[model samples]
Target: MLRHEFQPGRLVAGLVFAAAGTVYAGDAAGLWDTPWFVIVPLVVGGLCLAGATATVTRGIRRRSGKKRLGRSTLDG
Candidate 1:
């Protein structure tokens, strides 16, 4: 069986979008007092930004600790 890949970026973005949808749904039904437009972008964009930053940092750190191609530790 093939295993599913776990993606933190997609997960965080998806959760943010889902939450934004819920906020709109609640507002439409008069269950929420907050304005819809302001909160949705803030929530979604912030989470996406955080997710991107984390993904980039993780990649950078991983590469920084690894030996480069065409080079060996003994050559240093």
Candidate 2:
């Protein structure tokens, strides 16, 4: 059986979500201080931005390659 490859970007996003949830849980448990609470939102927002950028970049690259191939075939 072929194993699926692991994606670091996806892993990072998952970890960020987990961490944010843990932080929220800690706050509910009265273990998290207000000063440290800002980190959770920042981490989650950063992960979202990174993931979106990665996806858009990959899509643009793929489309550019396809267009290049089409243009080359047309010129030939």
Candidate 3:
């Protein structure tokens, strides 16, 4: 049995933030240059995409759950 439900939205968001952090780290380390305002859109877009993905995933799960419930009722 699984201990907890997996959250893909959080995973995507984490990856996005990690990428941004990596960019900043690179800049700090003098490996590359990152503009001060570059993070604004990166974070905002990532969050929006993650939210959309979560909504879609939830809808799909709910639909599948309803189908399973219906089948169980019919079989019993």
- Candidate with best TM-score: 3
Give per-model TM-scores: 0.56, 0.50, 0.94
Sort the predicted structures by lDDT, highest score first.
3, 2, 1
lDDT by residue for model 1 (34-66), tens: 664777576868687768867886797678757
Q: What ranges in model 2 sit over 4 Å off? A: 1-34
> How do the residues 1-76 of candidate 2 rate in per-residue lDDT, one tens digit apiece?
9999446567767777777778778888999555666876769696887698668767877899999999999999
Extract clashing residue pairs from model 2. Answer: none
- For each candidate, the alpha-carbon lDDT, in order, equals 0.73, 0.77, 0.94
lDDT of 1: 0.73
Candidate 3 TM-score versus the reference:
0.94
Supply the global lDDT for candidate 3: 0.94
Model 1, stretches more than 4 Å misplaced? Answer: 34-36, 50-54, 57-76
RMSD of 2: 5.1
Residue-level lDDT tens digits of model 3 in 17-55: 998999899999999989999999999999998998899
Report the alpha-carbon TM-score of model 1 versus the true structure. Answer: 0.56
Q: Which candidate leads the pack in lDDT?
A: 3
**In model 2, what is the error at residue 44, expressed in angstroms?**
1.0
Candidate 2 vs candidate 3, TM-score winner: 3
